[model samples]
Target: MVSEERRVTLREVARVAGVSVSAVSYALRGAANIPAETAARVRAVADKLGYRPNARVGELMAHIRQARPLAKAEPLALVYLEGDRATAKKNGFAQIVEASARLHAAHRGYRLDAFWLSEVEGNARRLAGILTARGISGVLFAPTVGEKRIELDWPWADFAVAVAGMSELSVALPRAGHHHYEAMREVLRRMSAKGARRPAAMIEATTNERAHRGWQAAWLAYGPAGAARRLWLYRAGEKNELAAWLQRLKPDALVTDNANLIHAAQAAGWAEPNERGAVLSWHARSAFGGIDQGYDDIAAHAVDLVVTQLQRNERGLPDPPPMLLFPGRWRECSQTSAGGHAPSLREAMRCAL
Candidate 1:
């Protein structure tokens, strides 16, 4: 039996490649700032030495790098479609994402800046020039309403790009957003636990499309079995039709994405916490119970993904874009008193029993 050769170290590879240890490490990871020829030489030497990186050690180093204080010089772009600000606010969508993105960017040592895609008039080349001139090589595309697909004339091959939501774009990029499917399932579970056997969902057609039909799909798959249990294209303006539908369906609990629908239900004479139960699929400050979409976590993860691409010099559309999903947190809002005293779901359930 022959003794195995000792494991090769990064320091040894650095000495053989005639470069500093840091240079060797950067070269292995294909990091920017080093000459192409020098990086190639370092890789060649590393391969010859049969050096294999330790997975655990690499993860530890990455964690340390991320925890270090951020440098203020680097900037990232938050690109939004033209005239989306007003619509986003009205729909209660963009504010939290923007605020959380800014907070996370600062924590990670990058300044987040906003830009409008409409500014360049759909000219990708012009947008590319603007970004390059500002030394910005990373961009986060905010969620767009009404637009199914966005086309940019810029050279996507030069910069790292990530989209904040599932809204389709011309270029394939990594996405970060809510776990709508899981959220719906969670609502069903909660309603069932509260003795709601005949649960139903009312969703707007456009809202369903925005979430990629996640709300409808989850309802159809996980909701109580029946054909008429799930209602789509629910319009609040049609009071008579809505009331008739409620009378026909007679669902013990209602799940919806629109706050207006709750008022409509009440107007239709549906008793709350007694005859019928109401649950919001999306979180609203005024809602009785619903899912918090975890926008802050989504924003933080999106920034981290963009920063990883920047550090690794991975630009342009990914060959196979990755997706990251965060599950919504359940919130109990029904048991609060006017004096501001609120009870947890468990406490409320115990009291009810």
Candidate 2:
């Protein structure tokens, strides 16, 4: 306890850098108003002086920012595929999740500015140039509807990046997405517990592969005995198999992401009105209930991951890239009805066992 070193202050760094405290501030944050070269030099000097930002002050600023106008927020990059449906489909899951990310980022004093890959013709070099010119340090890769892998040669070392949504990225970095495996297992378990003796999971092959076979694996691990044959993995336009499969299983319950297939079975007199079934995705929800895989929450976490990286001055692909997964929320039939009020995805299951 003989001696204690004093923490470096912004005032001290500013004085040594031959600039005002405001310049120092902008430079440290890599704010676009300041030149990139100036920002780089200032950061280097701060590093040499052993400067550290106070977390409490940052937390307070973030709280204050909550009350600020959208125009005042700093800009962050939102990278998405060109023509990748923001509207996505009739359900609009892609649109809703992206909008949530924008709102949450705004709450943190950051504005998510969209940049489609089409802008630069999928050229990562040109994309990086645009981002650098704008002084954007944080980047979020938006979700895709059907695309699984990205094919860009991006320079990850210069930016704090995170990807979000239902698809997986080819380039590894931090990501936030739905916990597909846990969700599938939970749904199957609930179906079994709710008096489903011969429940079957009818999933499409592409959807199953995209989720890394989480749906298939869950059915295999926990489905009813001899139910594997009942688990028909079909493709689009081959849904007619439902009638034959239904005849074979005569299942009293079902676990599926296909509302169209369910409707076909019901209309064909295979599925009874009282038959119980769990819809796998909210996007696929019909009059029957389903799981709401918190897309908004996943989007928020992606933005948060990018913000945290920027705060720590961390860039490049993280080692073993971290992934944050959120589980699904069960929705009841009432919530799926016309003019029905849907609750927040963050809430726990409100129906089934």
Candidate 3:
């Protein structure tokens, strides 16, 4: 009698195809993120090796996974790109985002690990090695703090990476952040509705550039006629120039993202926050409310971006890297989140890109 033939395993197929087991599985399932060429190659190799699917084993494993408690969670890294870990801990915004990311990672069956690029001597390559050694496959980069460009030559192909902010990094990776354009527009609209005709936008030059000039573009598109001309791209030591420009424009409302704008306006003898239409683009840590950026949501979304890629076994920089932005909620006179619903990420990207 002929003996029962040995069954081929996914590991054998992956070893022969020179791909990962997860990749082989995704390729078999025809996951959208899995490249078609790679999927075809995996299929050809599996066919040659006579690898047959074990439906009974697959179902049993699936059931076991569903019933098992999440005791051994996968490790994920959340790298804060600010100063040192000490500085990050001191930063209120950084602390808030970090806590949110950690909480969301726990909910997603991942144990979030914290790392500071500054603590690692700003050596991104070393950081990469450290993360890989710890068996971390997914990474979430905290949104960079300032307008300065972050130069990182990290080996990005080895893991799934996502960012919590805009295009400040040297390499363009998938990112999620506040929608500067829509937030600016919303602030201006709310101010206009509150009886401010001559509204001028005050922003920093590099800040606007980092925002893709969305602030200026929104001023032109949504504000009163020639409001773009009324914009004051304030820089350091330009308080005198700013005062003169304010005198010339005589704007009824100062819609600004910079906190310093309020102080400058005070020096220029502008009205108080309550008296004039002075509003903020980011409303956190301010009684002078304008837009609630929902930072907790943004941080959670960043984790989602990485987790999605990890589930699909996708690595490397994506083609036409996606930018998911959220339009902030308008907090008007009531000290509550007024109804200002942001569009979906895809819908927002249409206006943003």
Candidate 4:
């Protein structure tokens, strides 16, 4: 048998191209400074040899591309509104976001540090110091406890920032999380397809309002004319107020932010679908039918966005888009049944989109 040609290496390609190894590395990255002819030669040789750049080397070169000698390793800061250990632990949504951030950071050799602003005095100043010390390029703000927030505009002036929950924030930044409106819209459209009319919205006062808007938008888009539309706002302050509201509307299909609301509707004897004088939650969190919103995806995307800004040296938003919305799919909410409805929510939104 004929001997096979040896696989090419970067050194071999560099030798053939008559350029230093560093030049080959930089040219492949499109880094400036190398002469056009020299870069072209290196590229051509690389193509001929079928050379593959090492992934780890590429990451290092990326770091070098935006080098700031004084800056520390670009760390990620995860800031949660819940400062107390007990509350932060209890916030399931916050934990999910943290997990996603951790996974993404670990894969990239980046470090993620959780900092609770609620515990520190002069939270903005303290957070600024932390960012400065670690050369943090971005922040992920979980939902706030009451009005507490890290007003670190001074420190994050050149950094990337994103929020995980609640769109209403003092600082303008990009955001990624559950696309509440779209999710609710998909759920409502699916219910409407099943011949359910007179849909009503029961949303928690604290649940993202964007979700409520989605239900309303989808309902108006597909709900039959003359159908009743009731919006009952859940309040923790008032006891039994929610139950009274549900009793009064008695909608055929009730869309709630959670299963808790669905259970409440059942307690009031609204245990059937629209056709049977019962109300079903617009979307189920159960495996049968629901919207997952992929909180992990949202968290990972936020980290990516921050890292990108840091790498590009882009900073300052005359006013950052106050809100960034990522549309989510209903399918991620479940793997199986999707409630076994004749037409799935995904199938219904196929036309809506």
lDDT of 2: 0.72
Question: Per-prediction TM-score, please?
Answer: 0.71, 0.72, 0.71, 0.65
Candidate 1 lDDT over residue span 1-353, tens digit each:
11136757789999999999999888987799889999999989977876665433433455467663222126788888655445655655577777888877754546788777667776657776888889888888877666366766667877777888667777678989888888888888888888888777777777777787776777788888793445656654554577878778777787777645766787897655632344444344543566767776787788777876765556777878889987677766563554555545554443212
lDDT string, candidate 3, 1-353, tens digits: 11127777789999999999999989976798889999999989987876655433433454465663222117789987777777887877788788999887754546789998877888889999999888887899987758888888799988789998674888899988888888888888788777888878788887888778877888888888787688888777776687778778888877777645765676777753453444544434443446667677889999988876665556789998777999867664321223443234443223211
The order by descending lDDT is 3, 2, 1, 4
- Per-candidate RMSD vs. true structure? 12.9, 13.1, 13.4, 10.0
Candidate 3 minimal-lDDT segment of 10 residues: 344-353
Q: Model 2 reaches what TM-score against the true structure? A: 0.72
Report the error of model 1 at residue 155, Å: 1.5
Off by over 4 Å in 2: 1-73, 82-91, 273-275, 282-285, 334-353
Angstrom error of the Cα, residue 124, model 4: value is: 1.1
lDDT (C-alpha) at residue 105 in model 4: 59
lDDT against the true structure, per candidate, is 0.70, 0.72, 0.73, 0.59
Q: How many pairs of residues collide in model 4?
A: 3
Selected candidate, larger lDDT, 2 vs 4: 2
Off by over 4 Å in 4: 1-70, 145-154, 208-228, 237-248, 274-288, 318-324, 331-353
Error of 1 at 204 (Å): 0.6
Worst 10 residues of 1 by lDDT: 344-353
RMSD of 2: 13.1
What TM-score does candidate 3 reach?
0.71
